[model samples]
Target chain A: MSEHHEKPEISPAARRFIIALCVLAAVLVALEFIIHRHAYFTTEGQPLFFAVYGFIAFIVVVAGGVGLRKLVMRDIDYYDQGERDE
Target chain B: MSSLVTLLQIPGLLLVFGAAVVPFLPHKLRQAYMLAIIALSAYWCWGIDVGTHLSTNLAGLDLTLVRAEAITRPFALVFHIAAALNVIYAMHEKSRLTATSGLAYAGAAIAALFAGDFITLFIYWELTAFTSVFLILVSGTPRSFAAAMRYLLMQVSSGVILLAGAVLLWHGGQGLSIQAMQANTLAGGLVLLAFGIKAAFPFLNGWLQDAYPEASVTGTVMLSAFTTKLAIYMLALCFAGTEILIYIGAVMTLFPVFFAVIENDLRRVLAFSLNNQLGFMVVGVGIGTELALNGTVAHAFAHIIYKALLFMSMGAVLYRTGTAKASELGGLWKKMPLTMIFCIIGAVSISSFPLFSGFVTKSLTIGSVAKDGYFVIWMILIFASAGVLEHSGIKIPYFAFFGHDRKFEVKEAPLNMLIAMGIAAGLCIVIGVAPHLLYGLLPYDVKYDVWEAGHVLGEMQLLIFAILAFVFLMVRGWYPPEIDSTVLNTDWFLRRALPRTVNALSRPFLAAWASAVAQSKTAILAVLHTGEETSRKSGLVSGVASTGAAAAIFLAIFALLLLLRFVA
Candidate 1:
């Protein structure tokens, strides 16, 4: 009973589905790297420019994480709260 | 004499007058009248050509209804589209109150667009405030009523300041022609404040978040289009390149993303996102270059459709499920596939994914800002742009349509609602695919292209990369779930804090009134007590004093006879 209040339980199938999505994303990103190596799918700058790219990517990822932590959300009764109680 | 042709330039005014009479019509005829007026308003706005300036002096000042090919045309055109879309959206809605108020709202905004002079503009400005509040009232909710009143007060107060500015302008010897005024004058400052209120300039933008979410679904769609856009149009015309709006726009753009992120209400999220979007236009308007102005016009056009689409989808969710919170809703895509698809399209458009309406239009504003060498503003805008993607792009559709649907089962949006959403979704794609369709309607000829390789790659990098981040969060189960009653932005300043502060400050004065009553009672009681004591003392002393006087008189009579004999 206390466990129910702790958090809604995530089903095993849903958890597997989420893992599969993650794997799929990683594979797609790796494919982009491979395809770019063959003189096709050129990037804005050289893909090997790790120092500059890594810094920029890190900032973006960190900023995105911060934003997700801060903003990216919805509420349970966002539409239906505080109404018709006159 | 040919200038008088400008009067015919906006036949939408007469149609507005007709719409005001629509509600009074017998029940069956009401909708038909509303539809006819909408059609007529559309015709007047789109059919009118690119040249006609009607100017006749009211009092030595040029009260020119000059139809210059500038901001008004595009603004008016969007108003026409919004009015028609709103009418179609409300087709199945039975509320006569919403119908009348919606039409009157559109009419008032259209009138403001064609307003020849400051006086005309101010009148229509207030009218927009007056008519739109009814849409909220018809919702029959106490919260809606309160929100509408706040919306009305703020909107009307903005109009009052505008009117005051016009009066000052007339007195200060600036001619009444609807052109740019210098920022130095009293009228100029007043007008800026008025426009600031309407434009949802940073601190003054509370009314939007307060009111828009509370209106009826169709009412919110109509609400999204007119009020803030009208202020932008006015600001574009009168205060272009004022320099201050640049920073103002940047702050407006960046500040709302935080609030929007934390916000629970789907409608209010859109409202915050709108403030952010308007900041882009304000930046462009402040830039005041031809391309920047074109960008502002084009963005407003695209934004109207996409924003309305987003609202429609959410409204449908609200209608069917009876709730729009992310926590309560999950796995709804199975039920509302069409709405989901339309919502995704709206999301893509707002996110400015390459080949969407937002991509084609919003880039011009950012690009122009960059070209103008406002590097700091440009960087802030880029950061804000990323924030926009985080909040509106991923969060909206993800939570509502895609995320853990919390296993709630609900029917798809009604056919009427779907049709409305479909129309909006169609417009979004059309604007994205054929940017010229929208760009052609712009006040200036825009040579800027949105599909250049550099532009496409940059946007793709930004949006796709952002999506990767969203995916990362969801996979980790680190995302914030929708909750109930998210705190509102700037509105807390006026809605919660201001009223509380005033009450606290006035408590002593309130107590003083009772104290005054107590003091008056004490004074009257003291007077009565004094009278009672004096009468009692008089009664007690009278008998003794009279008896003593009688005894003294007897003794004095004998003494006086003896003394008289001696003296003789």
Candidate 2:
């Protein structure tokens, strides 16, 4: 089933968007050193504080969410079965 | 002053009852009439004087029906505007019930906002719940009907708790005023719980995620605009500065990020995102400072528009394609470029990207929390902002429009829907660019600069890094693939566990009761048979002799009585 459908190619416009986004992220990271931040706490003043925090947080949330699936994920008909019996 | 008082407009009445006349109008006239009602209501709300008016003494308590303050004005305005847009979007829906109920729902929310006393607020609050359920049921799916039932139970429970809280408050000598009160007391705690339920706070949040996605395409868009925002208005009005709300808000912000990640339904993902957005406003209300409250109002204003836009795009997708599940959709952007663009705008606005509506409004809450030295909470909020970017900002558009192409060919959204989305999308950008337009409506004076270099840079770093993280995950196959499935949440307890538990607990009891009823029925029938037999045995003799014998006995007695009376 997976082999039957050809993998869709990324369009030129989408490719440009991805490239531009990568470049923009790199530029923004460099600006963290040049820009003066009015940091609220001592740790936030560190270089790349937001970048590091945001990246780690995103991974943690995603990984945590996947783990949660182990606990809460059920067959799509989980509720539907109950409704039928009801 | 007397003449001015008499001239005061009750937009709530106009919206609520005026919608009842919609079915009487011809088909073409209905749309014009609906739009006219909304416009007139908007005009009425805008012209409302900045004071409590329409006070009446009822049952020895003063009830103020219209309280137009700066804090509530923005919420009411956005609700009216969103409702009008909803009317436009649904102009082609052909269901008078949807149109009428939608109008009444909006009217109830607006009325609840302007309510000066708990009694008035509770009336409109329950009205919203009662009327909005029709929108959900209008979807006409069995699942939607079930979801609507659950939604109504939850909502009406909130209203009942609110009424109980009001009664308690009145007994506590607080009078039925709708003002900030300490949550330490029983009454205050009950009221807070009520608002918490409607606000979709944590465990109480299941109804929103369960029902919003189950509503009709346009119904979801309408549902997105009201119920929860009304609770936010109430929170800002009464529960500000309450320490518990800050923690609650923070948790509200964080938990949905996880559920939204692997959720299959795109609309459900937006529902989760809506919960996250509400978290921001809750924090602002918790802070209760001028700036924080202002942030709450501005964020609510911005959220109503952009969230509606996001829901509209998904609705259009669902309208065109038969499903909104991410697993079933991809590469629709080529066919529905306009919807794609509108969805991306909504995504960016919600992501707090620079020059988007979220960037300006959400910062105020974050800034206030940081200033107040809630270092840990501020960090959590910042983290949740990134989480928002992942689920709502990237995941939604990626799977729905740009991921592995399923090669679906569908026309763009209908013209009225595009018009509605365009208007909402336009507002998102406008608010993002000229936030002062929103800021001016705040209850407090504006002093915070949203365009400061530090704030903007920090925001950009957080958002951009989050985007990179998404890219890395997608490229490395670390991202969870969307599957056709439902992820259980707190609603599982009510929808499945509670019913099964009840069934388990009641089966034996019900059997015993049924047996007992059968036994009792047999005993009663036996007794009735015995009585009938006794009566039958005596019936012939009594029937034959009764009339003539009774008359003779009566005459003899009467003669004896007459003789006795003469002797006396």
Candidate 3:
């Protein structure tokens, strides 16, 4: 069996945005190797510390929200008992 | 200077009492009058210096009405600026109630800043609540009314709790003067609880997200400036360096990030974002170092301008499009390009991109946490920084202006709103570029180097990579989609659980009361029926004899009594 990855259709502008993002991320990672960051802790001193954390943290926050929605989400008029205005 | 001390009335009285004339003035006159009053109030407030205070005897306790702290200058300055911006942003507003209440609300908050005693502070605290509640009420919807009531309940509860703590302080031989105290003390704990509620600390944060976004288009902007920041000012004054605040602030910083992600309402997302921003200040207060305190003050000042700018842009969008939900708004960049630019500026400023306000100010606090060797908390703060970028920096702009093109046929935001956003954006940039301007007003001298290359590189890497992750998620369809829904928060305890609990608890009592009432009615009717059967006419009245018969009986009784008395 072969695993298939779904690549959603996108506009050209969005595709360009993704490419520009990749370029920027690469530049930042390259700059990290050149610059000496003032790290207060051992983990912070690790190479590409901020870049790794930033990328992972953003993913985690969004993923956690996806899980949270299942538990907490309700209709817009949840509290008003359907007294929402037009 | 001594003679001038006699001339110093309370700083914000001009706006508070002067609001009386607001209702009577015409539109242009009202706007001009409000601006003039704010200018005059700011001028009067400027003359006040620490130790140059006026006191009066109230019920044998001396009350200071015009005391100033070193931190008071910056808070007062930003507050006046916010007030003036409100007047400008509301230039198109014709509702006299919003005008009067807005001015009075701003005035009360400024007054609270200068209060020297708990009693005086409590007065201004409740005044801010009473005046600003109208902003929520002005939305004129059932939800807004409910929100206003809940907002008032929390505000008034804070005031009452503050007073209770003050009385306990006085009872404990501590003067009623507002000063630092041990959080372990009963009075100190009570006071901290009160401040925590207004600061939107953890479970006490419900009212902020609940009420703010529900306010009218411009009203939400006015509502944002005063209340929580006032609580933060008090927290810095009273509870700075408390160890508990460190953990509490950390919790505050992280939880809102997740909630903001899936929230459909853009304004409410900002509210959650505001809560997240506040966590930084709280953490700064917890650190209680010179650098950290300066960071808190500087962050509050910059946060005020940028937050207001962000809210104003959204308000402009709401005003024209008649919706602020992320799911509803899209492709507004062409329609309100100026608003989009202003929103982006606010986003970058909040995201702490280099050369923005957050970079200079938020660094001092995070730097303090790191320097203090709290590695875990520091990491949490860093992660929270990325989370801030996700919601405020990218999501707000992406969904509202760039994502799904709803093709809203809306015009540009009003001229006055543009001017307000322009001025606020200009301030954010000025403070960001030359942080020394804001630093000079801080309580302590700043030693933190915000622009160090090493720090700058780290910050840029953090922010840029965060954006990359956002783009990555979007392209892959891994990001959570905004849907119209109610996201349960701590407010669920107040809005849902509390009411449901009350109804559940009262059910038995209500049922028993109903049964008792029915039994009483039956017993009364039975007595009446028994009397009616005997008399045939009706109850007790029918048992009475005719007039002549009654007179004869009375005479017989009187004669018998007379004979008995003679025999005795």
lDDT of 2 by residue, B1-568 (tens): 7644342366566788787898778778998998898888888888886898777888898898887877877887899999899998998798888888998899888888889999988898899999899989998988899999999999999999999999999997989989989898999988999999999999999999999999999999999999999999999989889888999999999999999988999999999999999999999999888889998999999999999999999999999999999999999999999999999999999999988999999999998998899998999899999989988899889888988789987899999999999999999999999988898888898899888887799899888888878776765557777777779998888988898899999999999999999999999999998777645735532454665777888999999999999999
Which candidate leads in TM-score?
Answer: 3
In candidate 3, residue B32 scores what lDDT?
A: 92
Off by over 4 Å in 1: A1-86, B1-10, B24-29, B50-62, B65-68, B508-516, B534-568
The model with the greatest lDDT is 3
Candidate 1 per-residue lDDT, tens place, B1-568, comes to 4543444355456555667577678755776676676776676666556565465666666655535445666777778778877877777777878888888788888878877688878878988998889877878886788778888889989989988989898887775656788766888999999999988999899889889888887888889999999888888888888788889999998888777766777788899899999999999988989888888888988998899889888888888888766666667888999999999999999988777899999988987887787878876777777777877887788788766657766788888788889988898998999999888878788887677654565555555555556555555555555556446456667665676688789889989988999999999999988777655735433456756776788889989999999999
lDDT of 1: 0.76
Model 2 chain B weakest 10-residue run by lDDT: B2-11
| TM-scores for every candidate against the unseen true structure | 0.84, 0.90, 0.92
Q: By TM-score, is 2 or 3 better? A: 3
Q: Score the docking of each candidate (DockQ).
A: 0.12, 0.45, 0.53
The candidate that wins on DockQ is 3
lDDT of 3 by residue, B1-568 (tens): 7544353378887789889899999999999999998998898888788774777879988788888998899999999999999999999988999999999999999999999999999999999999999999999998899999999999999999999999999999898998888899999999999999999999999999999999999899999899999999999999889988989999899999999999999999999999999999999889888888888999999999999999999999999999999999999999999999999999999999999998999999999999999988999999999999999999999888998899899899999999999999999899999999999989888988888888998998898888888877766767777789999999999877887788889999999999999999999999987776866643333545555566888999999999999999
lDDT agreement with native, every candidate: 0.76, 0.89, 0.91
